[model samples]
Target: MKSSIRRRVLLLALLPATLLALSLGYFFTLSRITDLDQALRARGLAIARHLAPACEYGVISGNNQILQRLADSALAEPDVVSVYIMDRGGNVLASNSLKQSKLAGIQPGDIPVSSQNDTVTVATRSNVLFFRMPIRQTEVQVDDFALTSTPAPAIQPVNAAPLGYVAIELSRKATMERQNEVLRSAALLTIAALIATALLALRLGREITVPIMKLASAVDKIGRGYLDVRVKLGGNDDEFRILEDGINGMVSKLHRAHDNLQEQILQATAKLSYQASHDMLTGLINRREFEVRLERALFSAQHQDREHALCYMDLDQFKIVNDSCGHVAGDELLRQLTLHLQQEVRERDTLARLGGDEFGLLLENCPQDKALELAEIMRKTVEDFRFSMGEKNFMVGVSIGIVMINHESDNVVSLLTSADAACYAAKDHGRNRVHLYQMQDSELAKRRGEMQWVNRIQLAIAENRLQLYFQQIQPLQKQEQGLHVELLLRMIDESGQCILPMAFIPAAERYHLMPMLDRWVMENSFKLCDAYIAPDSCELQTWAVNVSGASLCDAGFVQYLKSHLVDNPALARTLCIEITETAAITNLGAANTFIKELKSLGCRFALDDFGSGLSSLNYLKNLNVDYLKIDGAFIKDMADDAIDLAMVEAINKIGHQMGLLTIAEFVDSERVLLKLKEIGVDFVQGNWIHKPENAEALCKT
Candidate 1:
């Protein structure tokens, strides 16, 4: 049980002592004082009554001596200041007073009394009480004392009239003196009690507050992460002791939890560090980690007179496995190939998976010949390794490109580029081979040129330097399809010279940049149509713009077209979107979805370079298209070669059977045009039909 602070404070302070003294002394003093005043008043009234009766006879008889003796007797009692006996004519017949001057000429009969008690009136002022009694004669009823003399003549009927008055004054000095003495004793008792209470209160507060303040200091330390702090309090069976035990227990638990959390944090940090630098798939360092180590290797080779070799390895026939057995088999094959390469490489070499089907090896402190030997061994290991998934077994090979690193080596970028160029050269020459990087290799120069073209193409697109040209798709049948023109893309170099599409288009497609180019063409073509041709004025003038396979697969391109048509829906009618035959078949689902969505917006689709694929007719049946432009390879030579002529005639017939209009491209001569018309091809587009012209010419017209 906890000790009560209320009980302890009351016992020590003893407040009831002061309160009892104040209350009892006050009431006791007041009672005594009241009794003294009442006694004075009672005495005054008794004197007045006695004097009145005694003065009545003297007043009637006009005897001043008897009245004076009676007044003097009344004044003699304690606290009686003055006594007066007056006659009916308001004359002071006799008076006795302690202070004669105080009573001289004072008419007690004229004084208004505050209260009337029958024949007596009492008035008190200034600690003095006045008592007045009227001396009225009453009829006396008395038995005869002698010889029964006939009731003593019936005691003679006395007149009931006031003959005179008697008044007495009393003093309150003695009562006031006793009350003051009682108050002084009460004040002394209160002061003594207060001094004792204050001393006791100080001791009690020290006992309680010291323990509480000590506990508070310990708790503050615990709050500041000092888990070892514990409250040490000295008390038996008290709340402070119980509270101290609870705090110690809680801190102990918190210390253990904090230690456990610290260990867990360290373990998690190590795991995350490993995951950040290594690939989870093959347990090998990833490209970022590989590049960091390569940077170090380059520094050592440049400054420390060390020789290192970097080999960029690309797996050949990787796509065949992915295409044949899906990505699962491809992944398993890569894992197995990683193990095989690891077994052939030295422990000092750093092997990393650069990206999909590409791996990089850094052989530090190695000669060129030893690097070559090691590269060949790794190539042969991968070439001979067979990855088996269930009943299917696959053999894949790797092409190795080795760039020797020495003090003469360039930076990381140059070394990586040279390695990659050499790897490409090995694949180009023959698969499962090793090639050393050389500065003057023609393949490396070509690769570098293509890289330069990639940058140039990006810059050209940023600067809006791509131009559009139009070639007329002349209709051989002369139908109601007003006019159709195919738009061609050309690039304006930094020198402002127009570069043909063949120069940059292959590079753009190789780098998956065709989608950006396609969007640019579509946006500008709509703008050109809006400015030059009104929808109502030339409703049937269709402008055909080519869209690439990458653009067809991209869902964003579909939304781009939708948003533009939503703003100007009529432009869809004037635009014809052309897609190559191979691109359509490669991404058949996305292409079909793309074609259907745009075709619903009044846009027409033409299968460009038709009959280019092996199964063109089979794929064509599934594609929803309005036109098929025969592959120019067949059309350009159909005039001279029989096989080309037969191919063109067969494609035109098949297109018509499928209810699609056929257009022949590369119709360079009039003979080819006449042959296309005879073959029932709906359109012929080439220099012979109409030389290509700048699209801006249409705006001028």
Candidate 2:
């Protein structure tokens, strides 16, 4: 503020004063030059008038010497550069000039000119004035300075005619020198005055900027979190006083806010730390922190031969409690049950809430018997506990699985795998019981492992954690065109591995999870291929998503699809639900209805894994599937086996007769693709054709 004010004030004071001084000096100098020029022109004219009449007689008689002498007399003046005498024909009769050397920087060929008349003058190339006057053949006036003729020179009559012209070149060097001198003096005075004004402005600027600089420094400190910083300014200006007071008040308020902010930060950090490790309601360690401890237990078992026992416990009737009462009641029941469960275990035992109704325990140096005993105790405690919400009371139970952790339990997967399996087996047999894992029994272990996947697949679909894998179905023959990719569902384990559908599909099918999973795939596949769905789709692209048999038999499932797909007619046209050969065979009646309803709605269907079953060909006639994906088992060996090749050829012929496109799976070589093409298969898909890639990579919205 202070610097700007000083600069502006000084400029306002000095700019016009400087310009006025220079302007007055310029015009005064110009007026002086003009007056001097008029005087010089008059004097030159008088001289020319005197010389013109004297030359009239010379012009009349054409006496060259007389005219030349008269011109020479005129040039005797120091400033007179050149004088010319010309007759009326505009030819110079005689002319004289000062020595070329005396007229510094001027060329010898320079001549005076009169563009108008005697009054007209022009500047030469150099700084010399050029002028001309007419030489009149008239009676001469007897002046005091003129040569008085007795009867006045009657060589020509007065105002009779202009015999010739007289021209003169005058030097203006002295006039220019005077103008330069005045300009130099004026410039020196302006510079001196501006220098004084600048010094005065700077002195004033410092007085005002001192307080403002101090305030800016305070503001900078406050911006850097120094809330206590204040500006100190001493000035007679009322504005400075008000500014100082405002700054001090602001700093005071910020100092208070800083204290409150630090308290908030401390509280927030503590809350975040608690939430990171412990469950909010039960106050037990969460899954992440519990797993971290489980990892340490695994390391101890592997390296130190330390034996431990881990129990995976799940509340069996907790869902019933949540359904009967509200979630708040369920939370209260879980909180109270946490206390009873904690009382059943020793202080050294680590317990954690895995997720939802599941909990885990790590027992150090415990044998299988002790683990079973503890697990039973926990199960019995949960069975005996009765939870109450308002006037209603309910009983709950827990299923516990006890697994022995020893040197063999070297990894988190093995320990968790056994404990989770045992717990699920307990639930499978009956709730409110404990089961000990039998490690040496492969059948029990396999069943336990697979049954556990039922819950995992259910959770994956519910959580939308399943991803899609895509394999391009390329045209084997020239009949098929446009993009056609088959959708394959994939699951990710907690360890972040892609678990193949073969690993968990049996569990999903047994537990009736595939209907939910099939719908999940159907919806997400359309969503992923959203870019390809358009009313004006020029290319025929197909996305074949696999469907489960249970979904095929569900009567309401077709309507469920209709509800979602009706809003997206373009997407419906591109969808192809692939039903396995076995599924379609078993549910042929329902499958036919489902296929017909969907086909009418512009959605297509495919008989997936076509030749895996011997009766697949018989069932094909009962269903109206649009495409037949010949099972890979037969196609993979068709190149070497004659029966397999015959089967492939027969399927292609049958499918073509049915007006259905035939796609051969597991085409792992160019030879296989050629054989499939020779068999007249419409499409072939395998690693050799196109590797199964992330579906999002090939189809993204």
Candidate 3:
């Protein structure tokens, strides 16, 4: 039961009864006591006034016997305890008690008279009241009496007015005795009434609380998972009947709601599980689920000592399909393809969607030859199947790369990389074909993996792990000439072994980590050049650094170059930025912008690997460059091949026409160098001049 309702009803039934009884009792009892006190005060005042005249007459006549007689008359009253008389100037003239000592003198001005009736309480005792009254004299035959005393009055004025005051002291013992008797009787009656009311309230409360307690216990049981429990309200007409009805209604509604909520929860959980394991569009197993199955398949193959092949398939021209037919058609085609591939594959084989337009097949107990045969069949199936989108019918082809699981390759990355490389080779050789991974390809793949490690190498640079190696790029014609050095990036691995950039650069570009790696090389390269480059050399030959395409596009590159140049202006002019033709051609706009901005700062640009990519005459005309590096490919074969020599000659002629100096790369033999010199190449760099070596080793050479 709620205390608020119970308390409100109790107060309504009991508060007025308490107040009326208290008011009636106080009015009858306390009012009578107050009236009695007023009567006593009036009687005491009357006695005091009647004796005041005689006392004043005796004081004026100087009669001690008469004053003592008047004091005795005032004390003869029922409640008067003592009395005193004082002159107008506040000197005590006589008293009924203390004949040897006069009352302490009262200053007339200090006396207060009541404003309502000129009555005052002259003196107070623990159980008595004292009053003072001023005596006025008539002009006819007023007697002036002087009383004899032990100490004379301080002064007496000759024209002094005859004034006196009567003091009355009333005893309080009788009043206190009456008040105590009344309070004792009232307290006894109040205690008896409280006991009677408490017994009656206890009986009434039990009548209501017993049913309420039963209802509360039922509610608690229902709250603690016993939904079937119900309250038994004994009185059908009471408030508990309403409470019991409400509880039953709530429990019915809760049961219906719980069933509905449980159904919804189960449906939502199933939907989430489906979305987690399968692709939303094609309804095929997603990459995460596919990888889980692939890992298991690989482990089984290893345990059973049987061959298993993982073929990664990617759709060719899927972007074109999306662009032409829209993503809706693309999604429909993928769904159709998934169904077809599922039908074509063996029941035991696993077909999964790796990502957008990419699929994987896990063939258990299948050799490389069998896996290749299946991959070709899948490719043919895709090529032969005609897909209709709205009005157009088209055929799609796939590139498949297969990796056989073996004891040597146990990790997912290794297997995936091998498959990816084979896929790339298939696409490169020509799409719509299948390629098997080979051991020789693993070296290239391993190099690519190391390039991925380049990102970690860049992080190492920030942590000061990038060190420099200087190699001489000498002129074949003049050995005495101070050779300009090319700066090589060397990473100090965790084991303290040096790793060269050739082992990591390609991976850095593939993974888009080249910008950070390039910046590290630039900052550290300049710092090393500033510290190690000799100032006394005649030419003050520059140090060369290769920059990435991403770094070329960096908006901060120009500012970075300007700040470094500002720090070392002369050495800045001696610093050369080497860029490959591939990087220059890929992002021509940004490359031009960066080159022009830095060239204006007195920095030189060297076109690295000149003949390796699509090095057009248009780029040479548009790009303001200082050096043309003949690609190492032509120089490596220059000694024995006539085509290589002719290509070099053609490049030299083009460089001279463009007014750019030409440098031959990969000058690995004396004959290649002589051929380069004959071609009028301005510089040469290869093992023939000097192989890349540490700074200390370069200096010693």
Q: What is the TM-score of each candidate against the true structure?
A: 0.79, 0.52, 0.69
Residue 17 in model 3: lDDT: 59
Report the poorest 10 consecutive residues by lDDT, candidate 2: 101-110
For TM-score, candidate 1 versus 3, the one ahead is 1
Runs of candidate 1 exceeding 4 Å displacement: 1-140, 143-198, 314-337, 355-357, 390-394, 417-435, 449-472, 479-483, 487-503, 523-533, 538-540, 559-569, 633-650, 666-680, 686-700
TM-score of model 2 (CA atoms): 0.52
Question: What lDDT tens digits, residue by residue, belong to model 2 across residues 541-585?
Answer: 777888888998887778888887888787788888888899888
Report the Cα lDDT for residue 695, model 2.
76
- Model 2 clash pairs are none
In candidate 3, what are the lDDT values of residues 262-356, reduced to their tens digit?
A: 89999999999999998888788888887888788777766777678889898887787789989998988899988888888988888889888
| Winner by lDDT between candidate 2 and candidate 1 | 1
Ranking of predictions according to lDDT: 1, 2, 3
The CA lDDT at 378 in model 2 is: 83
Clashes of each: 0, 0, 5
Candidate 1 lDDT, 107-213, residue by residue in tens: 65456677655678887677777787877765666655656546443433256667877878788787677667767776676677677776676677567766767
* Candidate 2: regions farther than 4 A off: 1-32, 35-177, 197-259, 298-307, 325-329, 343-345, 364-370, 389-392, 441-443, 448-506, 510-701
